[model samples]
Target: MDTKFDLEKISQNIVYVKPVVTADLPTEVQDQVGDLDQIYAVHNASGEQLALVADRKLAFHLAREHKMEPVTLH
Candidate 1:
């Protein structure tokens, strides 16, 4: 899939905001949002959405495939 967002820049900006594959998600999150397909947005403490992702796994896979290291939280 084609994406406008630059995955490399995104990874450098905030790894936590980075997307992850379904297999990468924690058990709790997986249970809550079963089969996560995409990440709409990520908000900061200021309540401002920083980034918008179309496909979660796709994005993560792209990043990994491209050798881009995204930040990971928890």
Candidate 2:
């Protein structure tokens, strides 16, 4: 079987990677991450949080896997 992906469409949007303080998160979320002091957050252009990952590298990887460009936010 064969499938097609529209390269242009996939590359149209950009995802931003930001560092989030674990303490600022809710207690449930903090508990989920255990001893992690920080986590990487991936957001869309409108600033909606998409994914919270363990590291910067994984955050970028998540965006690339979805075909969106990744940009760092300090």
Candidate 3:
């Protein structure tokens, strides 16, 4: 049996939006995050984290700016 991973497809055309709470992060991370209660996490189709944005709309806009489609996860 054999399996192949398509790198280009994995990296392209899609992004996932999910919410994360700053308070749930490690203390060092929380300190760096500075007062934001929550954020929208943007990840590539393959689930590699891309960015943490302040709002869901901003996350979507960021994906659009990079020419990738943004989709909400649950």
Name the top lDDT candidate.
2
Tens digit of lDDT per residue, candidate 2, span 1-74?
A: 57898866754588889999999999999999999999999999888999999999999888989988999999
Off by over 4 Å in 3: 1-11
lDDT of each: 0.50, 0.91, 0.87
What's the TM-score of each model vs. the native?
0.28, 0.83, 0.76
In model 1, which runs have C-alpha deviations exceeding 4 angstroms? 1-52
Of 1 and 3, which scores higher on TM-score? 3
lDDT by residue for model 3 (37-60), tens: 998899987789899888999999
User: How displaced is residue 2 in candidate 3, in Å?
Assistant: 33
**What is the Cα-based lDDT of residue 31 in candidate 1?**
70
**Candidate 2 deviant stretches above 4 angstroms:** 1-12
Sorting all predicted structures by TM-score, with the top scorer first, yields 2, 3, 1
Q: What is the C-alpha RMSD of each candidate to the true structure, in Å?
A: 11.3, 6.6, 6.0
> Which pairs clash in the backbone of model 2?
none
